[model samples]
Target: MINEPSAPTATHEFDLTTAPIESFTALQEARQEVFSSERAHDAFQRTIRGLQPTGPEGLRRGLGAWMIGDYEGACDALSAYASDDVASFTHANALMTLKRYVEAQPIFKRLAEKYPGEPKAQGGYAEACFEAALSEHGEHEIDAICEVYERELAAAGEGFADSAEGQYLAGRAAEVRRDWQLALDHFGKARELNPAMRRNLFHLGLRAERCGLDLEALVAYQQLASLAPVDLPAMMNLGMLLEDLGRDQEAAACYDVIARSRPMDRRARLYLSDAVAGMDMYYDEDQERKEDRLNQILRIPITDFELSVRARNCLNKMNIMTLGDLVKQTETELLSFKNFGETSLNEIKEILGSKSLRLGMGRQEAVLSIESTQQRYVSGENAEAMNRPILDLELSIRARRTVEYLGCLTFGDVIQHSEEELLGMPNFGVTSLTELKEKLTIFGLELKPRQ
Candidate 1:
């Protein structure tokens, strides 16, 4: 017969200070020690079996299970704990790691609110908020989550930096979410406080590159290359960044170091070819000037076209910065933006139209023809090639031209000519015929067939 572990035997009042620190404390601490020692999984499991399984013991057993990669076992043991703080936090974390975000979120939030001083709980809360924000569509809910995390971290007291692990976690989360500046700041702080954390240098370099701080990124990547161990991600990343910055010889040396360890890596070989090509295409001064000009243009603030101050404020909040930016977007793209509506669009269009502009790309033919013709007229110029006699008129130029060619110069002359006679003219097809009839019809002059 299989034997099952007995139920919670000791129901004594839980004391934070004096509760018999379960035998599993030693076991939990041992698992951590074993993990730090970098022992094999089976050896760690043997150490776990030596601990007594009793009250508040479940927490250690669960943590041991977590350390040994048994997520389910960890969660089960953690759920049966006398103290909810650590076990609840660990259980929620296990759920999160298993991608059960919905299940983990509430538990994390509860723990965060209950143990506000605990950095692990705060980190878990931030993770839950981020996951929730990601599920939100259209609006950038991620920004709200980031602000929440930043605010909470600022509020956290002495234990905030107890582990550089929280800093690394927050930094990585910011990086994956494309918040480059935030990622760099967190990684930079983490590296400064814990210089032994070689990975932070690599992350700092990556985020620096993305945020357009190239010189800083190059220095960071160089440091990472020097400090990182064999098979380090930083080594490859450093070489790529150096190659991108047009230092081919230095990049080749870095790649050579990586190739020594990973000889058969096709990806590294391809990267070497790309690095060499990048050196050929690098243009320092010209590109820098272009970027400076672009940034200068981007800095110009757009005037509020919306008549009401309220509407303009709403648009500003939605990040609509320029008239040129507004014009490039379609009606659908405009409507899709948060706080933008038909009323705002109509008001903006009315304001722009008063200045002879539009909310969208203007009608090309109308604008171009008026522009070209008005200039010519202002210069006392005639665009006509020849003053031909009333024969061989181009039907495409003007309908009036076609009508005049058939001995129909005035409205009276048009009334006198039959539709069939006008149709007989060269290049005067049904399109022109229909257009003439429609024009005449508006003036109450009907075109009849000669028959």
Candidate 2:
């Protein structure tokens, strides 16, 4: 028979000063130490083992567990000391770590209200509310929570603003507001303040990508991959960028590692196959020359050509900036716009004729190609099924968040995304991709074929 560990002593009046340090101070120090340590998990376990495992000491143990990445253990230990202010704050943090943002939001709110000057309380509340909003909460609720979070942060003052956690919270708030540049700035500051914040680096990559800073995004992802080689999301994103840059062999190597690590993952397998096939694909010089010509033609501005003032004014009013933009609009669309008459349309047609192109001519072949590909992949009842709303699928919270982020509301929208596109999203990991694939399999659907 095995003996169990002894139960906690019933004493509530134990002196925290008698320990290695005051309980709250010890908790804070332990959190910082673990965050900055190279061997964070080992350091966290060792710190918690040295602490007494009852009463106020439970608070230290709980915080250490949270710092070490043991979210469930943090919840269990912290729950016993929920009556204490510091413990309650850590408990809410643990809940957030477990992705129970809805459950943690009110707890964070209570702490923020009770301690209006505490940056941790205010920042935690803000982060929880922002996460809840991302998970599909109403805009009105999110706005109210943001208002409170801002007030509390303001009250916490400059000292809080300079802290790493504060910068991270500011980054998250900026992200919720769709301010990608501001989010990236805050995340960069946070990383500078705390180099161990790998998650912030990941967020930096995501925000940079969204803001069209491709080089910055690539560097961020590369740094993160170097720090954590087994980080599938970072590796996958790096591979996608490499492939887009025409580095097929490097992209294939990234996929090969993921495939080896996750043998059962169909998405990884598919990506590896595509990358390998790409390596063997012949370069089409004629196609390249054609694309180069098309790009040069498209870059020619409408203003570069001679036109009557009235015709130029009409095109300007319609926001027709380039030859490509003008060619994409049909005669009907141009005529329907205000003050554009048949004479102006004739003038535009003449300009296009000079270039051997017609209105709305560029999209026809592209649409046909897409239609043909769609026909090849789906048929009969499956085609109808593809129109169903993505919300109908029982996806996990992480998967749902990713689909929403991509603005994919229907099965068709989801199917249009390749594995690389899905994995390129921040916070979308192997598990989420696998879950999505399983759901699609139910409808006999898969990701769009690689180009």
Candidate 3:
């Protein structure tokens, strides 16, 4: 045994002068194993332990750590030996993973300049700078960063251009510019390239929703929810989409799960209550019949009423088409018009009385509604300004449809109803409800609270 131990084998020695090529080859092998090995972290640790601490070998170890998602270890190893271009690039990447974008930008920029042919360097520099610009930078800085990102992306060549991550970055850039269609297209391409990219999926959902592609948004959110079941934002967004599509029970289940999971969360609790109320407020057969009859009554022409020629002519000249419109006018308003006297008023009252209605029956209610709406906007000196038209709010089509459906021609008509009443509309959902609330909030108003 002592004789056998006389000569130590080359493998048994910790040689500091190991060839750089051998270390590079070993690192390549380890990198492949990381993508396929079950014990990838252990493999990386073993490979890193055998490398020298201050050369290409150290850079390999750092890259291995990064490959295995050990960002802290990658930073420590790379920072110690980041003199060359490759080491510096890896160090900047580790910094990005650590969310140190401010510190990572300059290094990435330097590396990109040093190795203009490296796609990773160019892309990393663009991403780092873009992130830095987003975190409270001025518009000029954002514009400059965007220009740099676009230039680097173009220089990265066709291979990187067609890559999944490349498309994701493009989508983010388009999103910042408010180009919804372009963002959606790029995000879709990224997802097709890598179906497991949940970040891209989330962004795709947002873009789809913004573009009014409800089915696409629903599918994207569903896929993201499956990928990340406990993600609160995804869950909430999914619930909102479901509610918008009239799937109240499903939406309620979603809110209930979140509320139960986080009992102390006020937003979750409020959403749960809203979902339950929405479910309970579904239209019944009786309500449907009542709405149909009401609509029919509103469409009745004034010509159907039996009246003298003079009264009929006066009503025609006044543009009073329906019984509904006539009931909305006061006797004083009608008499103030030329050739509209007490005789014509008596005739109009007889016709309305036959239908169990009265002139100006809605006046008092209208006054109260307007006063209530004005009160909501009177924080200081904005009372008179609040009497503006609902059109001035510039709401989305969906929200505008909801308001028009409720006959809300003015801001006064809008504030007369509570949240429950608005949600009770057959076609109105959580999306329209939220949109209307946000528009009202801009004018220092909100939906009337539930009593």
Candidate that would win on TM-score: 2
Can you write out model 3's per-residue Cα lDDT over 1-451, one digit (the tens) per residue?
0001123222111222242323222333334334322233354467667877667777766766665557788788888764665556667766886778887888877876776655556667778877777875756566666777777677777687787768888988888877788999999999998775656888899889878998899878877764422446777888888788765545765676578767897887787677767764443432343333344345567887788898888888989988779877766689898888888888888876655455655533222222222222323344533545566778787777667666564565688789899888867889888888888887777667789
lDDT of 2 by residue, 158-199 (tens): 688887778988887777677777898999899888765566
Which residue segments of model 3 deviate by more than 4 Å? 1-100, 103-125, 138-142, 260-263, 280-451
**Least well predicted 10-residue stretch by lDDT in candidate 1:** 374-383
Residue-wise C-alpha lDDT for candidate 1, range 1-451, written one tens digit per residue: 0012223432222222233333322333333233321223445576556555556454566666766657787777776762555566667766875667777777877866776666556666666666656655324565666676667666666767545646865786678678777778788777777654545676788788877787778767766553312324677877777676555644755675577657897777777666655543343432343233233222334562335765587667767676545444445566677777778767766754443334444333123222212211111121121111112232355565556444332344455567777778767778887876765565555666566
Best by lDDT: 2
How does residue 238 of candidate 3 score in lDDT? 83
- Please list the residue runs of candidate 1 whose C-alpha ends up more than 4 Å from where it truly belongs after superposition: 1-32, 36-41, 49-58, 135-140, 144-179, 194-451
Better of 2 and 3 by lDDT: 2
Give the clashing pairs for model 2: none
